[model samples]
Target: TVAVVLFTSDLRLHDHPPLRAALAAADEVVPLFVRDPGVHAAGFDAPNRAAFLADCLRDLDASLRRRGGRLVVRTGPVVREVDAVAVECGAAEVHMAAGVSGYAQRREERLREALGRRGVVLRVHDAVITAVAAGAVTPAGSDHYAVFTPYFRRWSRERLRGTCPAPRTVRVPDAVRGEPLPSRGELSGLSPGLPTGGETPGRERFARWARSRLAEYEEGHDDLAGDATSRLSPYLHFGALSPVELVQRARSRGGAGAEAFVRQLCWRDFHHQVLAARPEASRRDYRPRHDQWRTEDEAAEDIAAWREGRTGYPVVDAAMRQLLHEGWMHNRARLLAASFLAKTLYVDWRVGARHFLDLLVDGDLVNNQLNWQWAAGTGTDTRPNRVLNPVRQGRRYDPSGAYVRRWVPELKDLDDRTVHEPWRLPEDRRAALGYPAPLIDLADGLTRFQHARGRGVT
Candidate 1:
């Protein structure tokens, strides 16, 4: 019997549940990937992510070939391509990882119905794309946990299945045909500092970073210039790295850093479960505050300034510029930027989320949208009305102003004390810097937010 392993987000060979199951259940397995036009149509295929995906596909193909098989590529809507491949390969079963987004759910349903009509069974595997399946554990009387603290408690106690090892061999029949693999060189507009992708690079990075930096992550993760946090996100985003393997390995390493890292992963799982239960939260407010948010028309110049990284707040600008260059940002930086746009600027969270999706290589519906909601006070954050003062945040997180100096070169000559607030410099010196003035005064912004939230404008 033959099986078709439908690769979606889970791209790598190691610790992949769907691939393992397909291999065990069939004599021959056709590894298939479909370049769905729907993704591009939905604006999910940003150049940076598309380029990274090309590297992942090529690397996956190379790995399969080494194990006596090769990946089959197709282009079309995912359901159509998958159905066509299953029938052509004479596959008795088609296995794929479960997905949380509404689009993914709809695709899975379409795949199942189409494949079933052709007498092929569609098997969806859980815990392949994520470390734990969404809806695996729930709080009392709820479909999903609404709060991270309680969710984390339940999540910590829920034992996970052991990780799968890579298959020793993958056998493919010669009759299957596929398009040529995509190449990074064929793409444009990628962030100049974007990291290379694929399982090999992912594994190597995890090994090196976990060894050299994981131990100090607890202390250094917030140090903007230190850059000590594991930059494993894009790899994880593409499924080039398995969350199961990562969590297990980190837990075994056994330290406060590992624990902190594990807690962060729980947050990833938390958002997945929340999104799974409430897919519409991707676009709608999860917890609406009746915000009459500013639109592009109402706040065009401010929005433009924010996107261009010239809001005149050194730390926020530095974070935005890093994202523009690297397609990634430090976690702390992301929070500050999100907060500045959603809270201080009082623009709609969707506005900021869309901009992030356009640029962030690791951006996805669950995390990007929900994190924006959290910052905008429309998500599960218990303290929804809180606002991050960017100046205070900068002083606390980027103390020496090295992170500010690195990206805002106009302020490079300023001393550490003044780099974060160069507007404080002597009038002549500040005017010479050529940096834009603070777009909105901090006090005025705060009053605006308070009034919008219906608190007395004190």
Candidate 2:
């Protein structure tokens, strides 16, 4: 008998539960990746992510070849492709990792129903993409935890399964047909500053991070200009690195920084569990706030200014510019820009979330959606009414204003305090610099948001 390992988001060879299980249960295994047109039709296949995914697929194929196997590439609907591969290889069992998004859950259900009709057993593995599987820990009453802190406390106590060893040999049938690996240049509209992908590159980064960066991550992660945080979000999103292995290695070091980094990873899982339970959170508010979100047309000018990095707030503009250039933004910048859109402008969170996903290489359904909700005060934030003042946040985080100067060249000559708010400069000086005035008075936006929340302006 043969078994099929259906590759989805989980692309790497090491520490993969579904792949390990499939290899052990059958005489020969088929490693299959399908390029579903549905994802492209839904407009989910952004150029940066497409390039990264191509690199991942090619690297995975190389790894499999080293183990006496190769990846079979197919292009079509996912369920039909899986069935065709199963029948071709004489496979009676199929294995895949569980997913949290609405599209993912629906895909799984369809695959199961289709495979069952054909008399092939389908098994979905949990905790393959995450350090802790969703729904593994729960509060006393709710089906899912709406709050992250309490959920994290419970998650810390749970025991995660040990990482699986990479197989030395993975035998594939000689008759299996396949396609060549895709080239990055074939994808269009890619960001000029996109990073390289694949498990090989990811593993090298992990080694360097563990040796040097991981220790200072806790203290330096929020430094906007320092660029010190681990840039592993894309790798994690693409399954280039195993979350389980990351946690294990971090725990081995056992320091304040390691603990802090582990907590962030836990935050990633926390959002996953929330999304797994309520996929509607991807679009709707997680906890309805009865918010009178401003119309897109009404906030069109403000949003346009924000997106083009002409917000007149240097820090905010710099972050927005970074996203435009790199298809990625610093974590702290993400929080600030999200707040600027949802709270400062009183614009809908969906608009901002959609824009981020369009370019973010690490644009995950769970983290992107829920984090946007948290900043919008419609999700699990304890202080749901909090607003990040761009000026103060910039002054605090980017003390040197180097991050701003790096991305927004117009503000490069401004002095430190003046960097945060260029409009404070004399009209002649500001005009000479060619910087725009403040898009909206900071206090006016704050008052508007406070009134919407049914609270007096601070």
lDDT of 1 by residue, 62-105 (tens): 99999999999999999888888877879999999999999999
State TM-scores per candidate.
Answer: 0.98, 0.97
Q: What is the lDDT of candidate 1?
A: 0.91
Alpha-carbon deviation at 226 in model 2, angstroms: 0.8
Best by lDDT: 1
Global lDDT of model 2: 0.91
lDDT values of the candidates?
Answer: 0.91, 0.91
Highest TM-score among the candidates is held by which one? 1
